[model samples]
Target: MTGIATSCATSPTQPSGVAIEAEKIRQELAALTALYEERNNQFFSHLHPLLEGSAFFKESVQHDFETFSEIKMNIKITRLEIRKEDVWTSVYWEGTWKVISDASPLLQSGQALFIFSAESPPRLMETRGESPFGVFQKAGTPAADVPISTRE
Candidate 1:
C-alpha cells in the first residue's frame, strides 16, 4: 500500500488584534443617547445646519419652527424609545412643539423618529419615518423594529 490518506480539517484561531469595534460603537451610541437626554434641543438643532447647511435652514425650515422662552420652541422630545440592531438603532420619541404659539397656550404634541448608524464619527441625523406636516411624531410608536405599543 504505497498510497497516502489525506484528512480534511481546518483550524480555528483568533485574530492577532483584539477587536474593540463593538465597544467603540456602543460607546458612541451611548454618548449620543446621553446627548439626547441632556442637550436634546441643542443636539437636534445642530443637525439642521450641519447636514442641510444654511440653505435648507433659511429657505426650508425658516418661519417653519417657533421659539419661545428664549428657547427654540421647535422640536421637543418628551419620551424616547431606543430600538437597537446589529450596527444601528431606531430612536422613537414623543415630542411637543409650538408651530405657531399664539396668544393662547397653543402647543402641538406628536412623535419623532431617528435612525442612528454605527459608522465612525457617526452620520447626519434623519427623520425619515417622521410626519411630513406634523411638527413631531408620537413617541410611543414612530415606526421602529420593536413594536412601540401604547396604552389608552
Candidate 2:
C-alpha cells in the first residue's frame, strides 16, 4: 500500500477596491455630519481640512449653529460615482434633518450632491441641491404668492 499527502491553502476574503473606497467616503461624510450635530468649536477645524475653502459653506454652517439649539441629520448615500481626475467622486445623498430650537423640532428631508477632490482622502469641492444646514433658512422665509394668468 502507498500513502499520498495533499496540502491546501486558503486565505480570508477581502473587500473589493470599490467597496473600500465607498466605505472610506461614507465614514468621512458620517464624521463630518456628526460634527455638524455637535455644534462645537471642533466642527470648523474638522470641516476646514475637508472642504475646498468655500466661504458660503462656512457661513451656512455658522447660520445653522445660530438657528438651532440642536441638529440631527440622518444621511443615506444613494449613489456614488468615482473617477480619477481633478474630480474624484460625486455622492448623491438623501438626508432627513431634525432641527430643535425654542419651538418644536422641525423635520425635513431633502437630497444633495457632493463633489469630492481626487486626493487620497477626498475633500469636498462643491455642494448642490438642498442642504441640511439651510433647512431653517428656507423654512423661516415665507413663500411668494404669485397668480398665474389664464387664457380664455
Candidate 3:
C-alpha cells in the first residue's frame, strides 16, 4: 500500500484530451495574433496553415492589408468550451487600425467567438461576433451585422 501510494504520488497526472486540445488551440491563436500584429508576408503563410485555406479568411485578410497601413491587435482568451466536434473559444480583443488614406487610427474593442476543428493542431473553422479579423468592410457595414457564414 505504501509502495502504491508512492508510485501514485510520483506519477504525473495527465491532462485531459480536451485540456490538451484547448492549450494547442490557444497557442496557435497566440501565434496567429502575433503574426497579425507583424503584418508581414510571413503572416499569410502562418495564417493559411491555421485556417486551412479558408476563403473568407483570405478575403478578410487581404482587405485588411489593402485598407490599413498599420494595425495592432491584443487578444485574450476569456473562455474555452467544447461543443460537439468543435472547440469554441471566446476572445476579448482590443485593436487599432490606421487606414492607408486616413491620418488617424481607429480603435476598437469587443468579444468574439472562434470555432476550431477538434483535430490534432486544430484549424480555425469560423469566427462569430465581433471578429478579431477585420470584418468591417469599406462599404460601412457594421461588424456586428456582418454575416458569419463562410462563403466559398
Off by over 4 Å in 2: 1-12, 46-52, 86-102, 138-152
Question: Which residue pairs overlap in candidate 2's backbone?
Answer: none
Best by TM-score: 3
RMSD of each: 13.1, 10.1, 4.4
Give the top-scoring candidate (lDDT): 3
Per-model TM-score, in order, reads 0.33, 0.68, 0.72
Candidate 1's residue-wise lDDT over 4-86, tens digit each?
32223222353221134444434554554444434243444434223334332222232232332111223333333333422
**TM-score between candidate 2 and the true structure:** 0.68
TM-score of 3: 0.72
Judge candidate 1 at residue 6 and give its lDDT: 22
Off by over 4 Å in 3: 1-14, 40-57, 100-102, 140-142
lDDT of 3 by residue, 1-152 (tens): 99889766634577766677879988888877877766655555544244645666666776777777788888899999987777888999998888763677788888888887777666677777888675556564436634354524
Worst lDDT run of 10 residues, candidate 3, spans 142-151
